[model samples]
Target: MLEIITSSALPVRHGFFTRKGGASSGVFAGLNCGTGSSDQTEIVAINRARVAEAMGVDAGALAAVHQVHSADVVTVVGPTADRPRADALVTAAPGVALSVLTADCQPVLLADPQARVIGAAHAGWRGALDGVLEATLDAMEAAGARRDRIRAVIGPSISQPAYEVGQEFFDAFLAEDRDNHRFFTHSPAGRYLFDLPSYGLHRLRSAGVGHAEWTGHCTYRDSERFFSYRRTTHAGEADYGRLISAIRL
Candidate 1:
């Protein structure tokens, strides 16, 4: 069975899928749906297909992008001929599922039931700091979504306790806004632990979203279910599995 987390208030069918029902084996175990990984193409396809079925949609209707870590948001009308390079996708059209793949980075799902628009974003620290959440909200607004009516839920992601960063990362955030220092805490090694989920919620609230929350599941700490890039790197693995999150009207 696939462990999918759904937001009750969103008024849409969506899930933050865990690494449960999948075809991939070995280190790339569970539902490793990333085609970009070294995992066999056939296995990745199979995993994605299972996810599509679980979402009650055709595999082709489950659209995602290349996700180049930019603030780009694409509007999905129907299945695109190709998955463009974007960090977020929004749609007013029902039956077309918009998805974002992540390991420790935030997978944010946005929906405004009244406006009948939904969106998904792949928000890492870089993308979040660069305004991907705000960009996603803007795209949803363009597709007839009202910010005040939108409920945004952030899926499983790396929490600050597990996310130790160097001085440069802290400096970069401080350079953006001195008040950003509130999102970081000094660690024993003199590094900073960053609160990515809190930053995400702050951005959503700042964008005027009616509701925003993080599911509070730390990917790095839960190795049995979630596939964390940081954990993989810490364990010296070649690559890590990407967890998929999707939303539909």
Candidate 2:
């Protein structure tokens, strides 16, 4: 069985899928839905098909982007073969599930059930700093969703304890806003430990979302349930699986 995390805040049918009960093997084991990975194409397709079935949509109805870690958000109306170079996707069309893939990055799912609009975003630190969450909200609004009525839930990601950063990384966030310093702490390694989920929540709240939350699951800490790029690198692995999170109206 698949282990899918959900938030009651979102009234739409959605889930934050973990790396479990998949057809993948080796380094890309367990629900590795990333098409960009070196995993067997057929296995990845099977995993994605399972997710689509869980979402009550056909495999072709699962819409996703190429995910360039940018602030770009695509307004999807129907399923397409083309995966655009974007980080987020929003849709008001029913039966079309908006999805995003992540290994350690944030997979944010947003919805305004009253308006029947939903969105999914891939937000790593770079993408979050670039305003991907805000961009998704803007796209949802354009699709007839209200920010005041929207509920945003950030799925499993690298938490502060496992997300050590360099001085340059801290400087980039500080360059954006000195207040961003609050999201970091001095690490025992003399570096910084950045709080990605907290920053995500801050951004969502600042954008006037009615509700925002993180599922409090850390990908790096739970190797059995999640795939972490940083952990894979630390373990000297070639590649890691990607967790898929989706939302549908």
Q: Name the best candidate (by lDDT).
A: 2
Provide the RMSD of all predictions against the true structure, rounded to 1 decimal.
Answer: 0.8, 0.7
* Cα-based lDDT for every prediction: 0.93, 0.94
Which consecutive 10 residues in model 1 have the weakest lDDT in total? Answer: 77-86
Candidate 2: stretches off by over 4 Å: none
Tens-digit lDDT track for model 1 on 107-196? 999999998999999999999999999999999999998999999999999999999999899999999999999999988988899999
Q: What TM-score does structure 1 among the candidates reach?
A: 0.98
Regions of model 1 farther than 4 Å from truth: none
Candidate 2 least-lDDT 10 residues: 75-84
How high is each candidate's TM-score? 0.98, 0.99
How many angstroms is residue 153 displaced in model 1 relative to the true structure, after the best TM-score fit? 0.2
Q: Write the per-residue lDDT of candidate 2 for residues 34-146, one digit (tens) a residue.
A: 99999999999999999999999999999999999899999998987779999999999999999999999999999898999899999999999999999999999999989
